[model samples]
Every structure is written in C-alpha cells, then in structure tokens.
Target chain A: MADHKTKASAKTSSPSGGEEAYVPPALANLIGYYLRIAQEASFQAIRQGTGKSDLKPGWYTLLTILSENPGVTPTELSKLCGRDRSTLTSTLNGLDARGLIARRRKAGDQRSYGVKLTAAGEAMLRKLQVIARAHDERLDAIVGKDKPLLMTLLRRIVDELGNGYPPPPARGLGKTSRTR
Target chain B: MADHKTKASAKTSSPSGGEEAYVPPALANLIGYYLRIAQEASFQAIRQGTGKSDLKPGWYTLLTILSENPGVTPTELSKLCGRDRSTLTSTLNGLDARGLIARRRKAGDQRSYGVKLTAAGEAMLRKLQVIARAHDERLDAIVGKDKPLLMTLLRRIVDELGNGYPPPPARGLGKTSRTR
Candidate 1:
C-alpha cells in the first residue's frame, strides 16, 4: 500500500501547485513541523556520513531498545515506541534477516518473543551513535547560543502536551501532589 | 498493488491473535515520530469537530493562505504548503466542487492561475477558525505556559534545519546576521 501510494504520487514534479489552497499561519509556530524538519536534516546528515547505509532510523531505534533492555518482549517495545504489532513484526523480521538482532520465544509465553541485539548490532549502534551525535551537534550549532533556550522550550512543550509530564497546577491552587 | 498489500497483511493478521508489539527507543526521539504524532493529534481533532462538514486541515491551510495573501497563485500556494502539484491539483478540484474558492487564469502567464476564496470559503474558514482555536487552546492547555518555550525551541530547530528557510550561510569567520 505504501509502495502504491508512493508510486501514484511519484510522477508529480511538485507537490504544492494548486488553486484555492489553504495555508495555516499557526504552522510557523508548530512544534511538530519543527521536529519533522530537524529529523529530516538529521537523517540526511547520517545518510551522507554513512555513505547510505541500509540501516534506517527505525533499525537504529530497534537496536537501541534491545541493547538497553535485553530480553524485552516485542509487545513491550511496541508500546514504548507507539507502533502497531504488525509494523514491529515486519521490522523485527527485517532486522533478524540482516543478522543485527535475534528473537527467541519467551519460556512461559509461547506466543511472545524476546528480542536482543547481536554483536554486529552493537557495533553498528556504536558507530551510528557518532553520526547521531554529529547530527545533534549540527542541529545545536544551527541554533547557536539559543540551543539551550530552544531545548528548554521543547521540554516545556513536551511536558505540557502530555508527551512527558502532567500539566502544572491551576492558578492559586494549593501545593500540587507529586506525580512523576 | 495497494489492495494486494492490504490483503496480504490481512491474511497474516487473521491467523495471529493480533498481539501488540514494541517499537525501539532509538526511533522514539526522532523528530519525525513527534511530528507524525502531532499531525495525527491535530487531524483527529479536526475530524472529530468537523467530520460532517467534510473540511480537512489541508483545506483550512489553503483558506488561511488565501485570506492572508489575496490573489495568490496556485504555484505559489503549492510551494508554501510543501505539497506536490498533482496532490494540490486534486485538492483544488475538491475545494472547487464545494464552491469554497475560485481560480482565474493569470493575465500575463498562461500556465499560472490565481486563487481566491469565495464568500462560502470565507464563511467556512470563519467557522473553522472557532474549531481551530479550540484545538489550539487545547494544545496550549496541554503545554500551558510552556507554549512560548516550545515555540522558541521549535523555531530554533526549524532555523537550524533550514527546512522552511533558504540555504545556510557560508562557513566563514565573521559575525552572523540575525533574522527572524
């Protein structure tokens, strides 16, 4: 389906030439848009640095999760990453085929599988980290001295948007109970 | 091809218990993931509030652009919206079918068309503004006072990425000009 969607739109030279268009001023202030652009920049940087390695950002993510939490089940990882089981299944299969990771059935749950990184996976992740760091540093450099301010703002937004912490207490409310 | 892909996936799911899977942490913090989630949230909010109206976020963006820049060209709007000409072509068809906007051939350029919102489009945009405001407020509510911070961070990221901006300044030893 994705392939068809891509192919169907592949013939178009430009994606935005049309009449009666709608533009949102708020888009300029959108965090989501910023994140998207940054990620794309990071991806491009990594791809260039690595000479177009087959490993995608998704593959790196899977490798990281397995490295951090050995014996983690696919279900647990899916919830953490907010992907559907089917998508994870395919990703796992691909990674396994590449011999970067291995999946074995859990002892008690016959239906469930435990995922872990292979030695090659660790080596790749370590190498990729350099690229990721360089990407992040470049992102920081682009913002200049304002990098800290920007990160602070993003963290605040993340907290506010339920991406991380809960909202602060309402105005004039008594001391809020701690809920981490 | 899309149908075939869907069918194949469906067949696999029928036999499985549809168990949930995990996503790796490496991909979790990528900008694309956050952008996708944010877009999904905004889309869902729009759908929930204006499902019967058949309005879409893309259409709302078009109306806003036209409202801001009256008599904007289709090609210009397409560039601003970051969508391909083909998709914009179909989108314009739908908007025109609803009588929400009108397009006229440019006086000088045979290939270009100037776009404007109709009275109906203006009215619809006005109504959508209320719903959009509510959604924005909800988004704001989520972030609370952190919105300013989030906006700052987002702007920094955007600036660094050069996603909506022109190419980065040439690397040299000189004080950089600041433009917001």
Candidate 2:
C-alpha cells in the first residue's frame, strides 16, 4: 500500500498535476469517520512501538486491569476490558499458558474462578508499562493541552452512544457502568 | 457475552455488593484506551443501525469515495479508506461480485483499473445515507454543540499520530494527502 498517495492519482487530475488531496464532502465532516481513522492511526502506532512482545494490544489493558483488581474473575475482566467473555477467556488462556496469569477456583464457588496476574505476569506488565507510558507521552504531545478535553469528549461518546444502542448491554447482568 | 457485566463481578468485591465499575488507574487516564473503546462503541452502533445491509461498514466508506471519485483506481481507494491494497482488492472483488461496482482499465493505463459504483451501488449508498444520517444525528445529540471541537481533536490525532509513526506511508507512490 506504499503507493497509495501517488498511484491514487491515476484517475484524477490535481491542480499541481500530482496527487490531489481530496476527501468527499460527504465524509469530510463525519465524526465517525475521524473516530475510526484516528483510532486506527493510534492503534498502529502502539503496535509499532511495542513491536513483537509477550503482551498484545488488548492484553496490556487486561493485565493492567488485573494488576489493579487481582482475583478479578473472567467475567469482570470482560467488562473492564469491554471484550466479550469468550474473547476474554481465550485471552486469559493464552496468558495462563504463558505463566503470565493464574486462574484459581473462587473462594465460595468451585465452578467459578478468580483470575490474577502471576509473578511472571506482573514482571511482564511492568516491562510493558514502560512501553505504554512512552506511548502515552507521544499522545500527550500530539493532543497537548487539549488532552483532558479530548478525553471528556471521548468519554461522553462512550457514555451516550455506547449505551444508546446495543445487543442490550452485552452478556452482562447490570447496567453498563465504568467508574471514571 | 451478555453475561459480561454481571458474570464479571464474580471475582471482585463491589461497594454495592454487585458489579464493580472500577478501571485500573493505569489505563483510566490514557487517551489510546478511550479511543479504542469509543471507536468500538461507535462502530458497533453503526453496525447495529445499518443492520443486515448490502454494504458493510468500511465498504460504505469505499463506495462513498467511489461515488464521488468515480473511476478511482484500487490504489487511490486504498489510501482514501486507509486500507491496504490487498484488503481493498478483496473488498472490491466482493462489491464487484455483488454487481454493485464496476471496474475497467484506465484510459492510458492497462495495468490499473478504475472502480465506480453501478446504479445498484448508488442506490445502496443512498439507502445507507439515511441510516448514516440517523447515526450522525444520535452522535450530534451526544456531542451537541461541541461536535466541531470534538472533530478538531480527533483530526489532530489522525494528522499528528497517524503520520507520526510509520509503515512508511503504506503502498503509496506520493506523500499522503487528503482534501478537506
């Protein structure tokens, strides 16, 4: 896809006789368009920064959540991560296999399990934290002073649009809630 | 996954004796985290609104680009949609198979093909426009008067962070450009 910027000019004439930077008016102003594009860009940067590592993108969040909420069950991890249960289960399995997480039977319920980071998991997370922090620093530089406001706006979207529609709250038992 | 919110509480003790809405302090403040969640929420909303439709999410963007820039080649469409060439090729094949788009050789370039929507594609896009409009309306209600500001923040992320890292401009021939 490296040829995207130049080869795209095949069908159109630019004022400079080169690539014409055009986005249709229809898409130019859409918030969703920007949201998707921005997220994609941000995500790509994270992957590039982390490179090949023990923790994948979503895994870092999951492990971080576990670090704060140790013994958190698979279900709670799912909501905290916003990933479905099956997906979370598979992810946990991967972590377990790698000795990054440990799953034990819940205190009162043999059928249910409590998931927590193992020593290895904590070690891995600590390493990833440095990478994550650097990633955040770059984001901070990009948004600069607007960082806080941008976060509020993004949170507002999640609060409104996230709950506004649904598969009706997704495999969960309570109203979707996120403590700030 | 419907059990996500409820089942997730199994391992954690909540003040309410139910699902704990706690997020790790580490992730709670990161812009990348929110961006991913917000985008996922918005993307899910779009899919739910559009329901079962001929055009998929990204496909709508591609078709819209094609509608405005008819005769666009695969390379240009890839950049406009921010998709790589191979992904765009398969998507184009699907659209072509559905009789929604047509691809023909460029006037002077036999090596490349220009893609345009057929009457069906146009009709489908028009139908999607209604759904897209409704989606935007909900977003409007969510963001309200701050919509423009939110857009600026998002675009800044895309512009700065998007090019800040690199796969080195994707398979493009020239510098990345987009007309406002």
Best by lDDT: 2
lDDT of 2 at B80: 66
Worst 10 residues of 2 chain A by lDDT: A11-20
Model 1, span A1-180: residue lDDT tens:
112234222311212211222325655565444444445444544555565477575566667777989878987776555555556878888888888887888899898888889898888788777766676666656656755555444443333443211111122322343232
In model 2, which runs have C-alpha deviations exceeding 4 angstroms?
A: A1-22, A164-180, B1-22, B164-180
Instruction: Provide the overall lDDT of each model, using Cα atoms, as 2-decimal numbers.
Output: 0.57, 0.72
TM-score of the first chain of model 2:
0.76
Error of 2 at B113 (Å): 2.2
Docking class of 1: incorrect
Q: Per-residue lDDT for A9 in model 2?
A: 35
Can you give the TM-score per candidate against the true fold? 0.65, 0.79
Proportion of native contacts kept per candidate: 0.19, 0.50
